[model samples]
Target: MARTRPTKRQLEGLLVTALYGATWWGILSSRTPFNWVLTVASGITAECVRHSSGRDRLDCLGDAFGAIGGISGDVETGIRPYTNGIAQTKTQIISHALKQLPMGESLQQRFLDRQGVNTDWFEGFEKRCAVLVGESKDGKTFLLKWRLQRFIEQHPDGHEYYIGDIDYGRCHEGDTPNTWFDSPVGQAVFTTADDIAAKVRAIAQDIRDGHDAAVPTLIILDELVDTMEDMDRDQFEQFMRDLKTIKNRGLKAGNITFVLGLHSTTVGETGIPQWLLRGVETIWLYRAGQERANFLHLNGKNIDECPKQLARLPRSFNGLRPCIVYSDKKLSVKAIPTLDFGNIEVKYSTVELSAIQQWEQDHWTPEKELTVLQKMREREASGKTPYSNRDIMPIIGIRQNQCVRSNEVYEHAKSLILALWESSKKSEG
Candidate 1:
């Protein structure tokens, strides 16, 4: 009869016995190095056999070792291992094993290498408004702030402004209290939505009348949807309209550019006007869906490609993430990087409340009040009910005042003038 091949179990048993015998002999001969070599060889041999036999290497090793008792015994003393028989911790072993694995470039490094844009792209960023949309927890805010920080570093002389929902809380990683607002190098940073709207109006006016400073202005509006939600419907719509107007005017004047961060869902949701969405010249989408793609005016072909690209993204938020970038030239998938600003301390100009109040008091003169009143009356007579502060501020020549806080000053002046007008009307009646 032909000799039958040994079964897998029988072969595994024979290999285990041979390894055990070799290990015991090595220990008895005081050859510690040989014992270690034998141990490694036994593991490798078992792994190979298991691979050939269609079994898990670890499972086969466990079975073989279990049948022969563990290999951790003192072979020289011929004593089985004791000490509660606890197995070696896998955590330490795995960690050490991982250290031996080949390392690759970091996600951020890989992304920057493949960005395909030159330094000129970042330098010319002030020419257009970029809107970044992403799902919640996809690090859209982080990436937005990173771009702002990069811009500030690249263009140190550029005036920057941050408009966001973060009033006093920590918004960035490792940010302490007031860090986000305190760090940005800007003419002024507005946290409240109302204040941001007023500042935008003032900036637009500055650009419109050729009064804006020669330096480029970088405006970062983080969580635009959140800011809009804080305002009433009418106020939100007007805010979007004002943003559109600012974008158009600023682009022509070459004075201001914006980086707006909003949720992917917010773009398609009601109450967010389409004109605001259309104002974006460059789009950065992070893990977006069809709704957001449609909102970006992406056709079906591009929309179908979005999910395919997003699916290949790694789930870690540790570094740069994949984004679908749509610009005036082309639409493509790209990686956006973030920065770690935890250790960098930035200096901010502190505005004393008393100084602000005093400045307003100084600028709010009787003559200015009379000028504002005359303009409002003119607009009222022309059938414009509830004249905007924007229409009234410039006519009062607030731009000529050389006030650093021109927006706040104009607002205070407008409120005082409106109150004065109401008082005069009541007295006349």
Candidate 2:
């Protein structure tokens, strides 16, 4: 059919519609504004009804709307609410699209190791080093903070520390009030990669020299892969070198722990060296889609040894998020509980110096034993007695030095014992 030219009024209406469409699109999202264009055409149909309300008017609004859509404004496609009730029908279409996914997913639910869907799989990691893999805003930090909270509460004798490209120096207040992560270790602990590198080297060296970190301690590194990518050549080398030393010593020492967070598990993508991943036997998986293939390429083994659910984590706001926990070469699905910080920000983590000092004193070491006499003097003032050397020495499994010099020291000990015996006898008499 041949198309007729639009009248002056129709042309003006079309121009107005075009202008509104352009403005709506420019100010909003990337997708084209199709719904809004149809809405504008509906307004034009309303104008047609207004002008010809009583004379030669279309019988119904459905025909008018359809005519505005068609070339000659005459074709009617049924009900008054747009063509074939598309506006209402769209809702049903969307419901079908989203609803069927979860239903189908439930049917395909298979566990790699007797995995129950969305069940809480408490991860047990025997190794000291662990890797947490997740993308941005996947609650990686929130989960990390929760782990730290649990560690602090459970291990009163142990200490917790946080280091990262960003300072997560806030209490874990998003969920529980008075959470263990309430103490922020301060932003100074982790503000820059260079500073982090230096601090790591120093702490690791101190542990090796037996100067500090006598008790079990957890050291957390957040977004280290991102930091590595931003490093200079020399800086990266130094940082990795320091990290390697720290990882090896910390893992082997058994008293130290390492929790490293990265967006990717692969060296090519994450900028984490192969050696770093090599030392980590346990990898806590998050909602990363490229799970199986990347781990296979990185470690020559499957890190996604769990049920295939990570790729399609259920969209949620306040529910347990699915995570695949890989440990001891075993794969399993875990519904990791989420943490909420409640917008609390603490600047510095308070460390109880007295508690740490008390631990150091109670911690049995040969060097500490040499100061036993001084400590005994303090104890005696409070009507407290120190452990007898003889009893403690046996349990200590000391290999005695029986040289002449050593014998002289023992003779001096004997003289002191005899003197004490004489004093006791006098007092008894």
**TM-score between candidate 1 and the true structure:** 0.52
Task: List lDDT for all candidates, in order.
Answer: 0.51, 0.48
| Structure candidate 1, residue pairs in collision | none
Q: Candidate 1, after superposition: displacement of residue 85 in Å? A: 32
Tens digits of per-residue lDDT for model 2, 66-142? 22333222232234234533322321221233234433222223221223445444444422567777654445665
RMSD of each: 15.1, 20.9
Who wins the lDDT comparison? Answer: 1
TM-score against native, each model:
0.52, 0.46
Candidate 1 segments exceeding 4 Å error:
1-127, 158-162, 166-178, 181-187, 251-254, 265-270, 279-285, 289-296, 316-320, 338-345, 349-429
lDDT of 1 at 37: 79
**Candidate 1 per-residue C-alpha lDDT over 1-429 given as tens digits, one digit per residue, 9 for 90 to 100:** 011233456447436434544444444454577667776676566556656666542333323322222222122124323332222221122223223333312322343344332223333343468777765444666666666666566555544454554443544343344445366523356677666665665556456557544556667777677777777665566567667766777756655678887765344563556655554644455435323334344444665665443332332223444466655555555554444654444454433335334444334433455566677778788999645656665655555453345566656656666777898579769
For model 1, where is the 10-residue window of minimal lDDT?
Answer: 85-94
